[model samples]
Target chain A: MSAPIQLRPDETFILNVGPQHPATHGVLRVKMEMDGEYIVKAETVLGYVHRMHEKMGENRTYAQYLPNLSRLDYLGALGYTHGHVLSIERAAGIEVPERAEYIRAITVELNRVASHLFWFGAFVMDLGGFSPLMYAIQDREHILDILEGVTGSRLTYCYYRFGGLYNDVDDEFIEATKRFIPNMRKSLKKYAALVTGNIIFHKRLEGIAPVSAETCRKYGATGPVARGSGINFDVRKNEPYSVYSDFDFDVPVYQEGDSLARYKVRMDEIEQSLRIIEQGLAKLPAGPIMTEKKPKNIKLPVGDFYQAVETARGSFGIRIVSDGDKNAYRLKLRSPTYSNMHLFDETCEGMLIMDALAFMGSLDLVIPEMDR
Target chain B: MGGYFSDIFYGGKSLLVGLSITFREFFKPTVTVQYPYQTIKMSARFRGHIELLADDTGSPKCVACGMCQRACPSSCISLDSVSVDIEVDGKVKKKKVLSRYDLNFTTCSLCGQCVENCNFGAIDFSKEYNLASTRKEDFHFDLLDRLKRLEEKKA
Candidate 1:
């Protein structure tokens, strides 16, 4: 638990939201100074789930550190893994096969959809709607099944290798993904009817916690958090990686900058992700999954390298400083949630406690990712 | 008065729409898998734990090369190899044989590095996922003994 927030006696009192509360998502403690159910001040205390992943990267070999990437954000593990792999690939000058790049794009997009689907359920659950959570998870299960068929693990997938994929995607995976697109579209329609059109849901979210584009810029928030403020910046389009440039998809933006805007951004992103997946499946070419000239022991050149990828939450960047050794001299994981959650201190002030919690939910703070 | 009535009407309509969605889902097939009784079949590619492979002579194919021990990222694998004098083709020769092979499953990340580095195909991920133990030491498995027991079962 964090130290009690300083407040004048009888004027305000301290309230600790979590480090154990389910609504905080993970072990996140928010020390709030409250005045009659209104937050006077708030501070988010992190590092509960810190695994020293960066230190692990320094000690372990480049290839050995790959598994740690998934543990950071288990829901969006592949995106982190992809960013790590891309960084190493760029640093080591490894050429990935075209088919492998296409496969990575498709699987990553599918993973993004799954992550957003989970967030949708969990966010609605945070708002006291349980039925939407069930529906969202039921739809997300199909994604897990398809990803499991190819990647082997349902959640913490260590599927992406440095230069290519761990294994090839069979026809069954492609067929299942193709079937999933239409099914997801139909579900989205139902979600709109069930949750989106519901007046209660709108009243809870609409115009609550309006984060400006300036606030997003100041905090360096990316993904839906930034896009909801109408930033119009997506790493896939702005700084293209893998085969993302080859595909065409819209970067959904909403100008209201409220919790509802963020929700709409994520929901629209699911549709766009589906489009990217469909395009990737259609354009997927047949080639060797792994590069022929893969080095048995991965060693990067003595230089610093950075790679950024658009994850479901936001932009995940990996920076590696290598001294031409097997292990990194310094490895920094630029987690998006950390930056996005930083705005909480300023944003939560003077707001009602329930709305503040709803705002926290909108940020989609994965504690481990922020702590790491 | 009309505006208030329409507001009520629209609110009721939206509430009804949400109710209808839940009602439709209620009658549909249950997605919950009754665990411990009805288990979903794990895929063939599911990674559980590393197991040693045996040869036709009912001996482990691991040549005491220590490749897997070196390749393990988590340092969870440890083995003791002993150099023994063996008679082969009526000639005495020294051969290194695995005396003890232990794996700390508590720390193992199931990264498949050890399996990939093994040239002899001596190790693979077994598809046994229902792992529950009361004591912590139960996770520390002796693969050599497990392999011998597997061989005995095969024989």
Candidate 2:
């Protein structure tokens, strides 16, 4: 690494918080200049886990590389899978069947719930609440079990096809999902009762790490992190890809712009996700899952297409510039966490060390996704 | 003096309230699952490793359609077809069959697209997902061997 930038006489001592630090979350290193835990300045250092996936996508055939989408943000693999498949179908001009759209919506929402649970657990852990971490993860395991049963994988599911789904939902799976809804609702209420009204949680979160709407927009923060600051932007609500338009659910937003607001936004989103899943299950169309029209083996028209999906953390956009080849000329993943993390430099300044970690936790910075 | 006394009383009351919440949960049923001994029941939709299944006739469900070979993102599947001679109903017959159908399981992301696309219901993903091997090639499976087992069961 280049020699540390020389600090002036009055400048603070620089502290590195690891690409390997457990608290930094997934191979992220933050360089902070601290005056005894009160940060004077901060910068996020990334690219530790960058695997050059976008370049690899171009060389592989369209069908040959759908699974690569899962590696980007493995926590919300369903969102990545859904986004890539939706974009490819749009690019190829293939129409997905009605049932496939509904299935996609249901599975993605379930994945969102799972992702939120994990975030809740991790965020609480960051605040030194260990029991809630275990409690949240225990609930999340059930969601994973459900996802793993249908997709035949967990964490990195490449289940969505270009125009449709790889597998059809059986009656048994649908019925089981019906059972999961009521149980999940109970879990959500339990979480609310457990954390929402807790004084300690409120004390740690309330009015802390407040990001104004202007600051959020300036930094291009999206997802709950942005929505917490009163920005009404959700790819599902705004863009309405897949069957998101069909489902009726409110996009929970809080204008408080505080850490508590961010936490509440995520909690409310879980409930909203459950609503979407319920609607999808009740009104799911029974028809062909895969489309009759097939995508070409080794071609995409020379054009650029930018597609965005509201992942659990934020809006994840994949920009592909195709020069009519098997591979993309340039593929850029606009990871929300990376941009959300940009605020860290400003937010951490003048905050205690523990507060800096709390601020980072509220951002929900998934380092692998950012590095990717 | 009055304000200080009031503050002390409220702080003590809230501490008791928070401690009560934790204490109540301590008596509640533990959510921890004893893994290995009591494996967490995988849902019907859970995704796991792909396995080739055999029928009563000991024939593999995989018709060598190559849908998986095409769908695979990692190019981990290797399949080749060959013709074989057989006797059926006292008559000589020649049939095309899968010579080689192997998957580099190490490279396989365990995405079920291959299993999802199989039209013959030949490939089934079992919940027996615990497979960690020393050699990379240990993940490979032969379709013919699985098929013969099905045929033997039928007889």
After TM-score superposition, what is the CA distance of residue A212 in candidate 1 from its true location, in Å? 0.3
My TM-score estimates for the predictions, one after another, are 0.96, 0.87
lDDT agreement of model 1 with the native: 0.91
Top model number, DockQ: 1
In angstroms, the error of model 2 at B87 is: 6.5
Task: Score chain A of model 2 by TM-score against the reference chain A.
Answer: 0.95
Tens digits of per-residue lDDT, candidate 1, A226-283, equal: 9999999999999999988898899999999999999999999999999999999888
Local lDDT at A101 for model 2:
91
Query: Could you tell me how far off, in angstroms, the CA of residue A336 lies in candidate 2 after the best superposition?
Result: 1.0
Interface RMSD of 1: 1.0
Kindly report which residue stretches of model 2 are placed more than 4 angstroms away from their true locations once superposed.
A1-11, A294-298, B1-18, B40-47, B55-67, B79-100, B116-122, B134-155
